[model samples]
Target: MQSVSEEIKIRPIFNTQGVCVINSVLYTGYECTLFGTNSQNEIVEQLELESEIVKIFPVYDKVLISTITGKVYVYNPAERNNKLQCVFTNSVIKSIDLDGEAIVLGTADGSVILSDVQGYGETFNKKMDGMITLVKFISLSSIKRRYNSKNKLVAVGDAMGTVTLFNTTGEVVYREKNCHSGQIMFIGELGNKILSCGMDALLIEHSLESEMTIRNISENIDETIGACSLVGDRLFMCSKDLVITLSADLKIVAKKRLNIPDINGFDVFGECCVITTDEHDIVLASVVQDTLVVDKVLIGDNDEITDLLVMENMVVVGTNSRYIRTICKSDIERQNENGLIRNKAFSGELVKSNNEECVLSMCGSNKVFYTGSKDGIISKFEVVTGNIRDSVRAVKSVSAEAPITAMCLYQDLLITGTEYGIINGWKIGDTLELVFTASASSSEITGIVVNNKKIHCTSKTKEIIVVNLNGGMDSSISGHKKGMWSISEHCQMLLTGSSDKTARLWKGDINSTLQHNTSVVKTLLTERAITATSDGVLRVWNTTTYKELGAIRITEIKDERIWAIKRYAGTEYIVSAGPSIVIIKDSSWEVEKMKEQMQKEEYIAKQHAIIFMKKGEYVSAAVEYYKLNLERDLKDALKRITGEMDISPLMSVVLLDSYKFVKRVSKWARSPYLFTITQRILQTAIENRIEISAKEADDLSKTLLRTAELFNAAY
Candidate 1:
């Protein structure tokens, strides 16, 4: 419910995996963990391949990845305790098959080779018309009326729809054409039936008993069947939009939509589906749920982060040569590293660490840190040990499509700042739980805080906004008022010191008016009227009725001026930090009676604007104060006070009506999209006024667009 503070970091996972989801299972050969999804999904905890993976095979606890170079990288989930890694295969291990001690390899140029794990290798090259696309083992019932392992046949589907079947003994059994109308996509077996589906747009049901192709499926399908598998009675096929779960007869039982873009890899485990998107985001969700939740987002920084450290009594922060930084915990920062400086802030002599890459970070606790760099490498930093560890964990998050700016720790959560000026947060752990976050219109967040289930953030626009932990914004308080020299808050009262030589009491919400000077509030003629309460008195106020009020008489100086006052405990003391300093005699009084008088405005409204014309009284009350250098001259302050003495003080009500209208427009953005038209009035005003800079106008345009997005999302 709390708003996400301005500074947080995040990555887009939609670009990595193309339609096929990535499944982040343990991998071998990369020397790093990979977070990949099953099909076209992005893989979580998967390693980014130094080379492109052309093919993959998931066998029980091991996943095999093959590249065009003929080498195979094997990842054993059991051996590494399900950690992602890369295992090298000396030879370009192309297509592989497990046949007891012998391994079959399909060469790049239409040749079949044989090899053994014990170093024996042989070239089983045979004359072929075309290159092999896929190899599968199948069994057909024979005269013996029994199907066993040795009797099983291997089916090789070529790029040109040619189907060649070979017995386990390497003898050609059956060769056929017209088997598929077009190029065959793949062929798999279910029971005694041979299922073939591909660009021909059909699932051919081949019968073992008839030794012929049976039914050609051409029903209830929108797109071409992509990756498919079967376990027991269920047949699963992935289409462009949805994953269809079918029974043995090809009857649709359950269908789930694959809505998000760029799914790289995907896998089904029991009732849940684990998927990775091209965006390097990992999600594990139930088939029944319409919206899937991201389990974890791998932190992938394509830069080289050199130095890292945990700060004392604060969150872990790291630095890189590119001036990129992050705050993280020690343990998480140690997941992947290439060895560098200590992961902590320097003491005494400050030296910038020489890191080569732009740093992206995720923090654990207040002292553990993790940083990712531009070279697709990650480093982990441990503050307590003062050491950097090599890749212990793999995070595949990316930011190439967009730049990530701010990142932080909200309690135990992760907050990230985006280039779009959006703030997003998620709970940090093995599971990424969604936390509340927000944006400051088109403003970027520079600081954030969380407490009492409320998130408070400060933005580049100089606004402080409060929102719920779930991102419901409560209030946005504007920091500065136009034309006011300085405005600040102390205790609960809003104080405004203006160039008009007046210090006015503002309601905490910038409402209400002070009563003492009905028309002319705290304006003074000497150009010096800023009030504060410290010790026992605040000078330059009506000391007649306020509690612990005070006045000062600077006999040595020429003009009476009050710059600042500080209230510590219950006493008021004044300090002159500006150009003209003044020493004064104590003139103080209690403010209780003054507070009582402020509650009743009619009693102080005895000034009649119609009948009695009082010249000096009204004009003197609204006096303007300009701070003149005491060291040079008191002539200006002195001359102005005497000259304005005979003038009648006039009161002007503060202009808040325009701000009120803007506030209404902001509220309108939340419920309707009509704020765009409502803002036409603001455009007219800008056209009448001299716009600041072209850049400022562009920024305002973006702010308006962001406001539109915010409002649109609300509905």
Candidate 2:
């Protein structure tokens, strides 16, 4: 299977925990490291910190990172010597927000401190009843213009589920006791309303005038609200497995299930939202016509895969969760070819066949599969045709005395090995009837295989127990120093992975030992022998020559282990699972060529745009820059076009709908230079009597005024 390496392309099929976006760059905090990726999902920087990161906030061009140890550090990515400089050290900081130069910190000890970034000391400090969970600065100007002098009000959410607003003098302006049944997850402002979501799965909008809830919604959201973000006027709330979008009136606009159950962090920029999962996967989604669409997923380890089975046209994956996901091979191919949008969900059917227990082993024939669970229950399911709510139907289930750890099918018999080293043989028919049972070893059985009317099984005893077909002990082979994890047979050749950090290939009495850097968790035998180790790497070896070919790093995260790897029969598709599910397809040269061609076209267009800009062709350059999403260059070209008297050249930038233009230039609100240039472009358009819809004109005017205020505060 040396050709498998050349023909196959590995892609994460399913989609970090702490993620935020600022100025188009995505920052994700994993462990004690902060990773920054650009819009194209390229790693821009990686900063290692002293402690586990708790929260990250964008402060002008710098990022303020708070740790679990109550230390705050400032990171300036553009600096020559990029380093984290400690700014403050106090009690554990649970939440943080910045307005102008003032930093508001909510501590786990129920203290809220208002300090400056310049280390000038705390301007105001106060203690509350419960541990502060969230703190945000909300502007009071919208409530009353005269209050603008003392406009900044601190919105605080505590562990007791209370929401409180305080002025600069620490006097409570508004307080709502027990606003939620659980700890608050988010607190922010939407016009004159204060929006807050909590672990109780409630999204409440409080009126600034009356200090009461204007609208509270719990419909369509059943899990804890992990995070919430604002895109334009829409409020997007992310729960365990769903993303719910609400309108300004707190009405449910759209809801989508991402199939990612453990969301750790989330943030939004423009129309795009980024989610980080507990497994370290980063999912980037966008709002398209009111629906949340997953654009790309940076897969991370979320669950430990227990078993893999290829049944019919589907690759069934059993994870640590109670469900088994069956991915259609055709769907994988179609998604790989047409890009992931053909099926909006971008996932497969989830079958909860094992009740609440984790699936340990799987065996199948044709469209029928049997799963063994940790609860010692065996469930048989048949894949049904057509659009059924349940993709698989349970035909029968049986309880074993011990947890089933390994299973295999031989002709009309199903053989299973259990946690107590008991080997069982059942006659397959209308009902699963036990035919024979024998003690294989004293330790837990890990693998079982039947060949030539003989049974070969490995267990925690570090020995391969051989038994006759009629429940009699034949002999035992000993070689491995530790318990074997997995075993497979192909044409009389046997491959076994063991906890001793070695995979041994045996043909007759002669065996070749393939040593790995870590414990071998899984092994597969095809044309080549593939072994998965605890070091998160797959080592390929030529079965015939027993020579190591190469290794693939399956998991990028540190200390992550590969738990399962299986190849689909008669196809070049392989599925590996650990933190995320990855689909490896063979004969994918066409896709690679297509990607290369697209990159070439983008490079050519960027070069042409640069040439046009140098030659003073502002309109032509603006068109190219806009198409390439080079926002900086596009804005510069638009500013230059405004200087000319011709209204047609200005059309290249100002002719679009106001919402699109506002979103495109929203990032520039932090830069005084770009902000002024944007203002000049808008002024020129109005002065030239450019025809624009009344709605567009109003939206543009409001966005620019808000941009002006933000620009002044940032500078």
Candidate 3:
């Protein structure tokens, strides 16, 4: 398999429902299209079904697909007109997993059905008392070794926060009620233990022993764990916004928060793990002492990464669009100083578009930005910045089909101009509305700007028209020989680029027709005025002096035309937008300064926590450690304050990690002072209304009582 290129690839899909990888091929099923890619990242097969496919599974040479209409179809990619293999008229199939001798299907009607490979004979079927969300197949050997069972089993996780294990014979091997606070999202077998996670921010590990005891290992309120896998002694898991590695006992050994969209799925590859998210990026990470070190990040060009498959030395990735890419592992393993696997050069094309609308105008202040497409749609987003990069959240949208040619933002008002020379003023509150409309020109409005309570607009009429906010023409300056293509204002200077292949820099009022000017090829204004014309060459000039300082050629494209130049505030970088978006990084030293500030804050907090702990202020120390969110430090504080106090933090720990409390107390909390402390902690927790699980409370009581009897006998 070849490595992915520096330029991100693009794939198009109608609507991606789910993606899965089997053997050496990756399969993604969307609206009505089922596409497959091989290890080489080449499209090998595609089958368009009748209905939207919800889940897909490959069994030997046949592909099985479950649709939204509660039916399953089996077909060979090489064949046509596939017949319905099976129909569940009453139950909508939500998920499918392959087991030893049965295919398990989870349904929306709280039932699980196990059938033969061809779906002709039923093996086992049962209602799980709630909507079945996920069903994981457990091999017979693992179940027999753990619980001494003689039958193969399947683990069913439901929406009502229950996980039940049943044999292929429809007999329940073990059932844990209230395994999580909310609906269970994932269920899998991690080595000898049953691993499950839910929307309640809970990760549970259930032993396969006949007793089938339960333990709550991790809890994160901000995100929910969606996928997990086991590699050696380390367990890798991912949430909507984080990827973490934990010990077999469930202690967070390392973690990395990507701050991206919701994670769809992930699979482990060698020492590294590949993760897929709802956006157009795939992250590869490895565990290194208390940190999930990011090895590389694969970003797609205007695409959302839906699923991925990991082979020996290569990885196959699927996107929302029609493209699948295979990449070699060694290509990303190359070291870099910035720790980013990004292409040094910046160029971007439109990735996800429902129509052929090109983005024409974009403007924003700070992190909130808006873009206008040719289809007359305006998209609003809030930017989320982090230590490494930034992402966005779509806020709202507005639609109008006149091909918004010009836009300006002023306080709570947005002024827009259409190609038909119509200027519309809008008020943005709960919803966007047009408050006033006026005829600015008879020709297409090319560019618009708002300054000092006045809107200045340029059009194909070869004139700059000025209008007041209340809606009346203030002035008009006509000088350019041809229609204006772009316009900008800086420090009372009006810069205009026209189709005559020339740009003029006029340093005077718009009402004045005569001013000292400089003839240039084409021009855009930021801190400095940048010009480009003929030769694909870009020259930067001082806005005040108009002196040429530096120059570079746009070699990424043959015919380069710079249409828009936007600078991100607080950074020296600028984004040039046209047929493609290119980022020009001028000063990147600011990134190091931001990293240093974060490290200093963490160091100061840790020192303060140590001081508080040394002074025997357990509650104060615990509060500081809680800010760090390390389980070991929090447990130490809990042990120190056991009998002396009952704080809310301790109660949270009890509810979040009960297994640690019980196991740790049994091992090190054996002395008389420690035993008394343990008793007091549990007693105070029960009296003060901590929501400890029944299973945990019982285990703690039984273990303590048995230990007390042994101590009395020894004494």
**Candidate 1: 10-residue stretch with minimal lDDT:** 1-10
lDDT of 1 by residue, 621-674 (tens): 222210111211222222223432432221111012444434433443332244
Instruction: Report the Cα RMSD per candidate.
Output: 28.1, 22.7, 29.7
Candidate lDDT (C-alpha), each: 0.41, 0.73, 0.61
Off by over 4 Å in 3: 1-11, 22-25, 37-44, 58-62, 75-91, 140-148, 207-221, 231-233, 267-274, 279-715
Q: Candidate 1 vs candidate 2: which has greater lDDT?
A: 2
Better of 1 and 2 by TM-score: 2
Candidate 1: segments with Cα more than 4 A from true spot: 1-25, 28-53, 56-63, 73-108, 113-131, 139-149, 181-183, 207-211, 214-219, 262-715
lDDT by residue for model 2 (353-388), tens: 545578889998887889889888888889887663
Better of 1 and 3 by TM-score: 3
Q: Top model by TM-score, which number? A: 2
lDDT of 3 by residue, 1-715 (tens): 1110122222332134344455544566645767664433333556777777776655555667778777776666445454445545555777777754568888888988988776577887898788888888886476676666665678999988999988778888788987787778667766567778776657777765655445554564246666666666777667766777778677777767765556765655456555556653455566677456655544423232322323334333333332233344334232345454332211111122232355556555655655565667766655555454343455777886687767777888888888889888888787778788879999888888775568888888778888888667788877787777667777666777666656666656432221113223345666666565545455555555555555555434454344444442332223232222333443323444565787898789889989989998887777677667655785677568755464666456554555555555555344443465567667765676655577866766777777677768877
TM-score of predicted structure 1: 0.36
With candidate 1 superimposed using the best TM-score fit, by how many Å does residue 526's alpha carbon deviate from the native? 36
